[model samples]
Target: MFDVAITNGLFFDGSGAPGAIRHLGIRGGKLVAISSEPLEEGAQQTIDAHGQWVMPGFIDMHTHYDAELVAAPALRESVRHGVTTVMIGSCSISMVLSGAEDCSDMFTRVESVPREHVLPLLQARKHWNTPADYATFLDSHPLGPNICSFLGHSDLRVAVLGLERAVDASVRPSDAELRQMEQLLEQALDAGLLGLSSMTNPWDKLDGERQRSKSLPSVYAPWREYVRLNRVLRKRGRIHQGAPNLVTKLNVFAFLWESMGLLRKPLKTTLITLMDVKADPWLAPILGPLTRTLSRLTRADFRWQTLPVPFVTYADGMEFVVFEEFPSGEAALHLASQDLRSELFRDPDYRRRFREDVDKRFGPRVWHRDFDDAWIVDCPDQALAGHSVGELARARGMHPGDLFLDLLVEHGPRLRWRTMIANHRPKVVEKLVAEPATLIGFADSGAHIRNMAFYNFAVRLLKLVRDGEARGQPAMPLEQAIWRLTGELGEWFGVDAGRLALDRRADLVIVDPQHLDAGLEAYHEDEMEGFDGLRRMVNRGEAVRATLINGRIAYRDGEFAADLGQVRGYGQFLRAG
Candidate 1:
């Protein structure tokens, strides 16, 4: 007798292959059969998945669930969206320090955790310090879904050569330090981590603080280390890399192609498309040559993901602020939002001259939406929505910029002013998704807390890709999207869950594609740790009817089962091999 049976559904097995209408039988948490053959006389529960899509559980390749995963292992936000596995420690950040005395204090630099709150909690709970120790502790927990982590480059660099010295190019690493980094990687993998992850872009704050502080230059490792590390991990692990300093439109894709060209051993690279600073309609043309280069390359498999939107924070004076290394990126950020930054925003003459100079150098480039043309679409309470700054200024008979500053001044320097910056052109997003090599990702959740959240893209893509096109359907088959979201991602990351094959982890979702919906209404009130922010969301998959991780029902009809250990300890560390 089987443990469970899902009868009457279209099975898209996450293999980029065609799906068939069939009944799926499950026993001991594995898909026992998919057939017209008679299901064995019942030994357990049966779910009638009538008129639904039954496919492998999704594997979210990019996410920033690092801190939260340690605190709340249930992975509520992701699991509810039908994501059964997640890749953490991207952008070259992770918690691999040893004996941090206070986990919260450590997170202040590594994550967005506020000092006062995280400090106390992490201090009380941080028992393990090394990557191996962190993995062991998390693996022992009865999590709602499986987790795979990448050894962060920053953390490794910091660990091997303290934060101060790691970036000091002059301070050549001794043999001891070099061996230490290699040892950390080995330990982390042995403890169940997959491979290493590094960021091409330095953290924003690092650039801001460099000015006036005489900060150490960032130690972006040479290609040799990356190559050696890739070779080491490829023997038994995998590598997930985010591109270097994103200043230009094709910076990420360009650097990735160059890096792949350098590697003697075949390795996979995931290229991230950060939101664009320009509003040019011809953005696709600029990206075309790079994408063409990507198409011609077969030396290594590459994955592409995009960050579709930017965050808006209305509580604090945090408006649409984008910073790059200018003078010093670090010192500039620290002063950018300060009273000093007013010089950049308030002085019309200065702003106009700066714009004029920039244009003369690089042609007319669009940055944020012009202050005069900006509007207020959403606000914290009912008092402030559907009004433009210009309109607000006219009402008060003040300048538009004056009105915006007044609102911020009233809320104090800490008061927030949020703006919705839509950088994606539907056509561009469509072209990227149409490619088989691309995977949907870059939901930097839990990291950019002050920013808006739109990480829930599974259903959103259906609306945009399916409904946004001329034919009112997707360019790629729906089955292909489903496969990428589930099986292909799992296979790429070596995750155990995203398939319906026998012995596959029972991470499944029943989707009602017809009734699927996503938008403002789907945004939930919960902020995990009470951080004020907006979340883009959607509702679909028939309430996720039942969630089985490793064959045990972790969630069913909004109710979690009594025991949650079936899915526990099943995740294996992914190595390059």
Candidate 2:
């Protein structure tokens, strides 16, 4: 008899094929049979998914859940949204291959993960000194979704060079250091890490008050280092993922050419965090030619990972790293005391400098030329709540910057503001989403916890695409959308569980499309330590009837499966085949 059976469902199968009525049989945590025949009577458990659509569970290709996995083993936010597998250690940040103290600081700076939350947990747990040790550590603490990690280049550098020297912009790894890094990569790959991930975006800065904080360690690595790394990845049949410098078209195009063309054997390259650069209109023109050039490259395969939703940031204060783009913004962020920062905002000279810097740096396009797009979401003064910064500035006959400072002075630094950063152009977003080459991910889950919550993006996108279709202009077929989230990404990353075939891993999600909701509500939860009212976003989609991981029901009927004991580590640690 099967362990469980799901009957009478419309199955999308994650194959980009049309949906059809099907029945699935699960046993020993694998899909043993899928057919039209009803196999419910002999099963120990049965789910009558009569009106739902069953598809392979989603694979979130980009996330920063590396450190958070141990602390929050349930991974409720991700599993609730039907994500059964998560790819962590993206943008070159991972806990393995480095000291715990250094990993804690790096997680705090690069991913906005609280040091207090991670440090104490790491101290209590058995130390993981190598990638294999880390994998074993993860295996001991099971989560709701399977996790696959990449060896972070930053941590690799820090392991070879001390943390102090690793961040030094001028310092380059010597031949010996490079060889050490290569050896570590080999060890990590053998230990089940997918491959190496790096970050070269100049804007991707480490959060701290110290010098050499301008860019991540991977940014300072010479091109030859990357070439050597790529060669190593090719030798092991692994992929390379990174965020290329996108400040200019030439920078992006050149990086692509070099990354793809430098090595004799093409490595599967996944470039991440691609978005609609509203600040630079020339980016659109550059993408067209660059994509064509990448297409012509025979050896390498390239795909851009993007978040198709509007780029909105909701933050309580200048603590958000995005504000660091403006001069002196970094200084304000580094101030340990919120009251001290508030006092600084009240200073006339400081206010003047902020105004001048904002004007000089961002000019009118700071809010994408729409000042009304930036508004106060929560404030101490009830009258100011939901009011735009522009409106308040106009009322006081003050510059927006001055008014912003005045508000901070009045309400302290904890006033919450929501700003539309980019991707406000619906047509542009639609175009990007429709592109076959673009991978539908960049959730940044388990990172930027307080500043923003994008963990529910998968369900949100499903609702958006379906809702658009109901309005007549479909973004893409539902089958295609499923494929983007599942088979396409799973295949590219060499994961075998995205498709709903016989003998495949039973990672599945059941959705009632007719009842799916587009709106998501953000709430504060004390999930992380030291940070009060940490924000988490949850999909309101009651349509998700059940989600199964490895044939075990992880979530069902708007609740996580209660049958699984207290240590609900039902998830497997996925390794590249």
Candidate 3:
């Protein structure tokens, strides 16, 4: 007898196979049977998945749920959209190994999570001091989705060499400190971490009293430090997840060189990201040939992470992170006090510098300085809503850059705007989605909560593939797309939650294909449960009919299980295979 049964569903087993009519039975949190014929024995519960597509639950490859996982284990934001497994501790901000204060400092700014919310929560609820302690805490929690983690390099550096020394560029770790870092990494791997995640992207800065606004600890580390750490990952056959310095992008070759396996085993490396940015129209095309060349010419195991959908971003005034990428914007963001920020905004010198920075169109940047691309979503003056800031600036005979500052000083966060950050060109994005060397991820799921809304990144990817095919511009076959998100990522990172086969863990999703439409792209917000009236940007849609993890339906038909967040049986920690 089955504990739970799904019948009459067209299931794709995450093997890149075409859909087949199949019935699956779950028993003791494992797939006990998968058959073409309906099961003869009836069980405790049954779900008639008639027209829905039953596939292995989607795996979110990138997220910053370190704090949210502690605050709200349900993770309904991602889980309800069919994500069964979530990879946390990406972008060099894991909560493991570091003290709560240090971890919170490294995290809050870069991820855009509020400092007050995260810091206090960590101070109160956090007790873990090492990977094993963190892992044990997770084992006891009723996790909404299976969790796997990378040992964050910033966390390691901060733990070993105080936050000050960690971010001090002149203060390279002594051999003893390096040894301590290596030992911590080893202990993490022993406790079943995926691998190391480092950051060279100077844009991601620190948040807190100490080392305030300094680049991440990993950024301060010399190449030798990464080499020592990568050695451990290489020996263990684990993965190295990193980001190249986005401003210059010259450090990418070093990461590439480290990945080569001409004589020695190549380090399995994945970097963030591969985007079609409006700022650099040439980047998307050049990265293609570069990726192909690396794949063809070198004996390296390297992959570029790509977001599969349009990179539309919603910002509450100037509270977005991309502002931290440039010097002038960084200056404004450095002042945490609203009064000080306003003073800076009022300063003519600051405005002139900002305008000068904006004028440098050829300068390397992530946000194109063109304010014309951004449209107001909300404002104190309702008439300004839905109008591009640039056009209004032109109408007022003012530079777009000047008007941007004026509006920010006038409205603060009461104003909201949306802009196309990248992947605006459909043809280029379709090609990137199908790029074999590029992984379909970079959703930045749990981070940038107020400014980014891609909780349903997996669903978006599927819709992109489905619609593209309908438009006679198929990126890849539907099966292949499924495999990319599920089995392919699972296999690469050694996480075990992707495929569906007899005896495998019962983690799956039932997707209603007809509901995969434009609604998934709708802009919406839900007040973050713990934070008082803190409305976070989110995606709302009816695409997923059901999501099951560990033989139990965690979400079905828009209703979450009553015990989804309170009980321990829904999901657990997924160790690397």
Candidate 4:
């Protein structure tokens, strides 16, 4: 008898094809039968989709849920958004291959995850010595979605060289240290890691004693180190995921050329996270050259991953990672107490210095330079809601920076701001999405849990493409959007879970297209416990009627199923082929 049967549903098979009404039968956690004829002979449970669209559950290719998977295993927020599988360990940050203390600080600095919450969880549950140990630890926990990981380059450096030297940009690993890193990577691959992930973004800083330190350890590594690692990944036919230096277009192009062209044997799949085209006008001119280079490359399949919408960050205080870009801003960010930070902001000298330093260094071209882009989303004063900083500053006859500091000082830690950091042009994003080689990613789900929200891109894109217009044209068709979010990502990651077919794992989502706009707004929620009441942006998935993982109903009717009896561990650790 089949475990469950879904009938009369509009099925999008994740292949960019038109939806068709079909019946699906599930047994032993796999799709056993998919036929136009209903097979209701023997089924333990049945779901009448009633014209709802049944598509493969979404796969988020870029996320930072490495530590959170152990700290908060339920992962309900992601599951609610129709994400059935998540790829963590992005930007070269993973839980394994480093000590718990180092991992905690690195995560806190780079990803903005709370160290207090992560450290204890790592100490109590995580096995930090090896990748096999880490995987075993994850298996012991109950997960809501299937988890896959990449071996972090920073973790490898920390494991071999100490944290201090790893972050030192001047230091390069010796021959022995390089060999050790290679051996560790091989061991990690053997233990089921999917690939290698690294980042060279100048903005990715480490937590230093007095202030934020230099770039991540991986960035300091010479080109030889990356080429060697690429060779290792090539041998296994694995992917090489990276976030290139976005500060300069030449740096981005150089990384791509070296990674793909200079290597003896090019990496199979090299994916780089591209900055939002509208975020910086400087990046817009490079897109054409980048695309041309990608097209000319014969050795590797080079592609860029981008967000379908602008990158937004909602914060109650100035503790976000982006603020660390300013001089002395890192010192201000380390002040854990909001009251202390408010006092610092109230200091006249500090405020003046901060304003002068920012103006001198960044000028007017930076994305965050225009205070009008920042809106007061949440505050004690309801009158200020939806108002931008520029408007309020002009009314008070003060500089925007001065007014912003004064407001923070007045409100202390209770104030909240919503800032758009990238991708102001939806038309540009649509054009990028329309490109067959572009991958829609950069969700950044678990890392910036308290400060930013991009976790519900799958559902948001679906709605946008169908109803929203961009560049005087409607967004891509729903079928194409589904394929980009599902099959394309699954194919790139070498996973079989993103398609609805016989013999595939039965991870499915049933959605009501008519009510897709309902409950789609992003709101604040305090879900992570023991993290100083920090609130994360929760994008509600209103249209999702049900989500099934491996043939079992994980969520239904806007609530997670109770059948698991509070032990929701239906997900498996997907190893690379």
Q: Highest lDDT: which candidate?
A: 3
Candidate 2 structure quality by residue, lDDT tens digits, 254-293: 4465446454655677787456766655454346446746
In model 4, where is the ten-residue run with the lowest total lDDT?
A: 358-367
Q: Which ten residues in a row have the lowest lDDT in candidate 3?
A: 527-536
Candidate 1 lDDT, tens digit per residue, 211-240? 212222222576556655665665664655
Best by TM-score: 3
Q: Using TM-score as the measure, name the better of candidate 3 and candidate 4.
A: 3
User: Compared with the true structure, what per-residue lDDT tens digits does model 4 show for residues 1-577?
Assistant: 8899999999999999989899889998999988899885688989999768899999988888887777566677788878898998888888788887777767777887766677777778655589888778667667778888898888888899988888777888899988998898898888888888887766677663533466777878887888778878878778788876655535655555644644455554445655553346566436734564675664446677877766777766565676766665765776777878888888889998877755553432234656787788878888888999889989989888888888888885567887777776766667767665568888888877767777788887887786664334677777889999999888878876689888989998888877667357547575663344655666775778888888889888888876432464477788877
* Local lDDT at 81 for model 3: 96
Report the lDDT of model 2 for residue 179. Answer: 92
Candidate 2's TM-score reads 0.93
Query: How accurate locally, in lDDT, is each candidate?
Result: 0.57, 0.75, 0.89, 0.76
Better of 2 and 4 by lDDT: 4
Report lDDT (Cα) of residue 529, candidate 2: 24
Order the numbered candidates by TM-score, best leading.
3, 2, 4, 1
Assess candidate 3 and give its TM-score to the true structure: 0.98
